[model samples]
Target: MPQTLDAAAVRTWCSLALEALGREREEIDAINVYPVADGDTGTNLYLTVESAAQAVEAVFAAHETGSSVPAPADVVRAMAHGALIGARGNSGTILAQLLRGMAERLGDGDHLAGALHRAATLAREAVAHPVEGTILSVAGAAAQAADAFPQDAVRAAYEGARQALDATPGQLAVLERAGVVDAGGRGLLMVLGALVEAVTGEAPVAPVLAHVRHEIGDPGLEPCAAGGPAFEVIYLLEADDAAVARLRTRLDGLGDSLVVVGGDGLWNVHVHVDDAGAAVEAGVEAGRPYRIRITHFDTTAPPREREQVQRAVVVVVPGEGLAGLCAEAGATTVLARPGEPPASGELVDAIRRAHAREVVLLPNSAELRHTAAAAAEQARTEGVRVALIPTRAAVQGIAALAVHEPDRRFDEDVVAMTAAAGATRYAELAVAERQSWTSAGVCQAGDVLGLIDGDVAVIGADLADTAEAVLDRMLAAGGELVTLVLGEDVPDGDAVADRLERYVRDGYLAVDTLVYRGGRGSTPLLVGVE
Candidate 1:
């Protein structure tokens, strides 16, 4: 085993931590009592580590195309940034600050003990009000132990954290009353154990407590305490350090459990408050805030009436317009850049973000089929039932969505959506980049080209004439509905859409045409006949 951290070791640490948390999420969540008593500490830590792992993987991926390996500093920085943006809950936000502190002190890895001390210090500063019998206490104890045993610091830190976690009940009344140790401290111990495993070849065994409290029923659906805050607000903000400093003050006054973590003009703000709108407005005054989430807690629901999260639709689209369209239709849209297609890892990340038991994946580009299928398999291994719909075009995916019924059985639903997508025929209108030979004939560089079902079918000089010819050929095969999606470069005016509609009216009496704006993309227009 390696004695010090490098990019590879850092990557290993992240993966180990995420897997550990995933295994213990429900157990940690069950015993949660401090900081509002919402039993999601384990889930929050898993998500935070998952984000950090993704960022580290991205750094390694960027270097894979070349021969260079990422520096230890680069890996640590990515881990810190990922945790900052993806942090959740009170414990999670503090954990982000701790990781950031380590990033600040990371060097040749000989100073592992020093880095641990710095991390503990930074975490303490990030909290609005530091309390004992929490993750902060565990972090401090671990750092002190590491400082004493610098030769074997990683293992020392894990043992120190586990011992501190055992003493948490004496430090806090809530935990003592609940017959459990601090939940956040327990999670910190789990993370430290992973770090120990990373340094040594053998994994550390988790400590078993004698006075454990096993919470009955689904803890997530339970109500909060009588006098607690009614809402949870989270958002990512873009602002300077001075602005964030002021924001921290404002939010601290507005609510409890306030955490603002990040630096260099980007930060993630999370808080619990009765005035959710006021909290968000304070962020706006400081800087621009987006991806805002506000959830209201209901205390009156019975256990039987508590609602569970439903299955979700996960889709990959090329342009912003299609993303918005899919989002509006209740699908989680992953935007694929013009040239850089999403990898299997990215697709898997999107599936995890969906946070659903069942998922329907729409890889709207033909090139993304294998990647999407691979992602689906990975998700299945993680206990998520995923269905991959091999949609070769955005319009085909749209057609499939139109017929989707999540309330139906999973297999039945997949079959219906697949059939709907398969029944649609798609084509695109583009301008030839250079003189090229086609099925119709050789075409000039500026000539309009109509590609039907992935082949050049009609070539002409005028956009209107070429579109009409393509529509005529498609209608000859007998289609009842025609979808016209216009791109950004298309000339302003309803000329193309109107002319096509008039042509259909003059010849095909029963065909109906619908038009949609496709925003900016490579193709000038996309046609779907169903």
Candidate 2:
């Protein structure tokens, strides 16, 4: 086991903690009974540590660029700052303070025991109403254990936190009734266990809570679950400690789960209150607050498993109308603007936010192929099963989504979606911005160009004529259904749809057609035949 902690060890600890949390997030969320039962404690902690790990990785990247390594103090500070800024929910906000306190003491020539002791005190101070049988209790116990066995700091801390976690049910009435330990305390114990593994290179034995029971689905026992304030408001505030003190008192009166963490001029504020506006306005009265997030508590519902979300779809589409359509069809959507496409990081974030074990990704633009593939690889690393369908147009994604069946086997579902997307022939009507060369021939600025499968196929002065020509060509290849996506620039509104429908009716009597408004900033019109 490592006798001394350093920057490298801290980085390792962050990674280990994130991995452990990722694996156990759902379990911890299930046992959440204190403060509020929104069933996101595990996700919150994982996200908070994920942010810290990312920040630590950034530091390493910067140091690598400089051909140097960051000092232990600098590494610890970055970890704390990342946690503070990215802290989510009540438990996560308190955890940020715990890490911040440890960073302060650890950087000031303190030993592991002393730093842990300081961490516990600061965590207790951060909470507006410090209660027993929580993470605060577990932290305090770990500190005591560390001081008592300074030579084996990591093991002592883990043992102490584990014992404290086991005893939490007796300390909190809600925990006893729910037949579970404090969820936040359990999460903290996992972090401590990760630290031990970082030092020893051997995973510690997980603590067993044999007394704890699971009555999650029983309605009779469900109503016994704890409840809290209506809305949870969190933000980052830039203010003096004095101003923060007054703000704390005002928030304490507003609601519970009030935690104000951070130091100096920057603070991470969290509170559960009925009046979200009042909580935010209180922050304004204290200082400038930004990155504010508010979540309403669905008090009637029971805590459920988020990490076990069976399947979800994440799609990249252009225009708000397509986004709405995808969302209505139960898919998470990322909007691609006219001149800007979503980066790989955006797609990865959307995949994570989708919160599913299995995800079907639709990159509905040719330029996004590589980016979407990269995102899929990154998400897979985080244990999300991702299938990237190279759909070159929004209409192809629509066709793929039409055939999507979450209940089917994953591989079969992927194959069906892939086949549907590949079989759909897509084209778009766009105005030429200037005299340009095209596959159809040279075109003037006033000309409307019909692009089929990423190549200009026809050009005409009239929108109706151009669209008709493209449709007939697409149908000549054989199609039973025609999808018309009308954009904001379609000058004649329903006239364009009326004309297109009439054209298909007169010539292709066996074919059916459908129309959708593609919203503003989209191409003049999009056509898909399948």
Q: Evaluated with lDDT, which candidate comes out highest?
A: 2
Question: Could you give the C-alpha RMSD of every candidate to the true structure, in order shown?
Answer: 6.6, 9.5
lDDT per residue (tens digit) for residues 1-530 in model 1: 34458888889999899888878887888877777666778777776777788778889989998989999999999999888876777788888888888788875465778889999998988788889999999999999999999888888888888889899989988787778888888888888888888878679986887557755443432246776788889888999999999999999998888878778898889898999999999999999986576767554443253243467788887666777888898888877655446556558767877888899999988988877887899799999999999999877888888889989988999999999889899888889989978988999999999988888999988888898899989888999888888877788637777888888888899998887777654367888899
Residue-level lDDT of model 2, residues 206-301, one tens digit each, is 778754545543332334234557798999899999999999999999988889999889999999898999999999999999767788887766
lDDT of each: 0.82, 0.86
Residue-level lDDT for 3 in candidate 1? 42
Per-candidate TM equals 0.74, 0.64
Please give the lDDT score at residue 431 for candidate 1.
91
lDDT of 1: 0.82
lDDT at 351 for candidate 2?
94
